[model samples]
Target: MPYVITRLCTNDGACVEVCPVACIHTRPGAPQFYIDPDVCIDCEQCEIVCPVDAIFKDVDVPAEHAEAIDINASFFRQNKAVVGPVAFETAWQMVQRAHAYAASVGIAVTAAVVDEAGVPIAVGRMDGAAPRTAELAVSKAYTAAAFHLATADLAAQARQPWLRSLVVAHRGRLLPAAGGLVIFDGITIIGAVGVAGGSATDHDVLCCQAAFSVLETGGH
Candidate 1:
């Protein structure tokens, strides 16, 4: 289970600093930090460093702050896949990085990240991007997480008759598109990232690739 950041979090950011996987995050001007259940390694590093003693394991959370458990998990409800511990803050940063990469290449796009269970961890769209692009990005992410393969590769494989039926069986949840790539923690498939809204499929692919590269490089 994941650790919960309670009401006592003072926005100190110490947990964020100590997290080895960079999973803890506080939104801009937010009152407290939130631990991303998907990305957390469950190392208890955050719990040890919290000066306010606000962090607690899922089962140990105080009743008054009990709602925080759902609050933390609900952050990744959209899309669906079996994913490991991933920090919401890190996932959001990955989207931001992907968006910036698209902009750098003169493209406008939407980016999404999902955990292994295909649950959306974070999503972002550039100004003027089409509304449908967001949905496509998320669908592609879910496909990658479900298949443990990049959506581009899955798209190619799905061309076979048997694979095509498998794709159809998903009832539109599986989008075998080029812009989705699986994320890994060493050899373990942890999640995926998807990109859409570019003029061509290659543009989307480029954005997703760049985003994964950011994760590989420690989001530098």
Candidate 2:
């Protein structure tokens, strides 16, 4: 079976570096290294050096992380599929007209840009964030992008006991505050940005401002 890097893979590159057959691709620049299953010999050595314990036998991937499996499989498509896009900008450049548009603001927040399919195109976690803050920020951005709605809007909708119940029923962690913005470019949901390390409203506004700035300046 072709060994797949599930969500457990943390981009450590240990597997890529250790492969004796050199089947795993280890080019100078690539998003989290990948193993070319077609070239791999199923050696268990890769399982040894991984620091994050991310390696998994192909059949062991859980249902919740199935998308990772699909991502790996699709990389072999005859026509290269678009992975995603991300560009960072100065706070003002990203959120243009911020001084005029928003009165109350919060700490400078990092932003993530995602594609239509809810895959990250780019991510930026501002310096000094808590250890897991990056992951939280990305998750919020993805949540905003997938529903094509602002985080605040979702929060508002969830305020209804029934709606909140339904959201919880689906096992969604929809926070009711701020910190995420669904990006739109000329009626197309091009991406989303989410901010953490601040109040819900603060984070939401920061991300929204960034989204607007990106729209004005042709994206970042």
**Which candidate's lDDT is highest?**
1
lDDT of 2 by residue, 43-87 (tens): 555767778765666787667765655666665443234443344
Residues 16-116 of candidate 1 have per-residue lDDT tens digits of: 88664456766577678788786664657789889999999998999999999887776544323544645787788889888888888888889999988
lDDT for 62 in candidate 1 is 90
Which parts of model 1 are misplaced by more than 4 Å? 1-83
- For model 2, the stretches where C-alpha displacement exceeds 4 angstroms are 1-108, 159-176
- Measured on C-alpha atoms, candidate 2 has an lDDT of 0.56
RMSD of 2: 15.1
> Residue 69 error for model 1, in Å?
34
